[model samples]
Target: MSATTTSPRISPVNPALATPTDLSSEGVAAIADQLRDLLADVFALYVKTKNFHWHMSGPHFRDSHLLLDEHSDQIFAMTDELAERARKIGGTTLRSIGDIARHQRLRDNDKEFVEPRTMLAELASDNQELTRSLRAAHAVCDEHQDVATTSLIENWIDETERRTWFLSEIAGPR
Candidate 1:
């Protein structure tokens, strides 16, 4: 006599597939794609900020390190909100670091040593770029009539602008 063997069947599901969202598939896709890019850039910036924070050295190291840590935390906090916003709209978001690398447009600095001034300047430039990207994404949200997303983007833009201002002040002529 032989024992019978059986296996449970599993179905594959595609999260990227368009679902029944209140927003149109076309609109959700467009906005979510923009949000994905935004998320990637924010994540990259967060990592870069943390890198500078950890490696900081100079007369102003104490202040700069603390500031970078605070900014990095703020940048990281945005990631969850961004990913959730995409999913709430029935859109797929970054799944892994690879996905972030693929979507991110921000450049990473891997130098063994970056001057404090240079770090501040670089972060300021990055924050400015992020603000511009946020504005573009806000436009997409407006075009798509995604009020919730638009509202969220508005808050992000404000936060980013504040970050840029802080960076600019810290990096000002010295």
Candidate 2:
């Protein structure tokens, strides 16, 4: 005569995780979705930057490596900010590397070796693309009246532009 035990009821998905905001659900979804994708691109760029930094081998190895390290740090910093911004506005964010890969528009670099100048040029182009994407996201924020996110995106755009400028200068007109 064994006593039968009843299973505890599982609670449904909590709505509290979706933070409240003045923006409409559509606005929140649009902004958050854009941000998630932007964050994915940022992650891709960050990884690639580090890859270049680690693999750097040239006469200017020291300078190129240092520059990529700094750039990768900047790019990595944006990931948390982007994720938090999305969460703050009542939307979900990337949960895994797979999610990032799915949303990322930036291509990955897996080559065994890339020339120093080539790396710089590729990174500059990627940063340019990232700048454009950031501007597009800013437009979405403007449409949604999300000034906070807009401000953050503005700073990120500036940073991306600066990175591009440095890389372009170093790579010399390419």
Which portions of model 1 show Cα errors greater than 4 Å? 1-19
* Tens-digit lDDT string for candidate 1 (15-57): 6554666786667777778888899999999999999999999
Error of 1 at 107 (Å): 0.5
- Estimate, for each residue in 1-174, the C-alpha lDDT of model 2 and write its tens digit: 001112212222149686878987777877877887899999999999999999999899999999999999999999999999988988878889998898899899999989989999999999999999999889888988999999999999999999999999999975
After the best TM-score superposition of candidate 2, give how far the Cα of residue 170 lies from its true spot, in angstroms. Answer: 0.4
* Runs off by more than 4 Å, candidate 2: 1-14
Among residues 3 or more apart in sequence or in different chains, the pairs in candidate 1 whose N, CA or C atoms overlap within 3 Å are: none
TM-score of each: 0.88, 0.91
- How many angstroms is residue 168 displaced in model 2 relative to the true structure, after the best TM-score fit? 0.5
lDDT score of residue 170 within candidate 2 = 97
State the TM-score for model 2: 0.91
Per-model clash counts, in order, read 0, 0
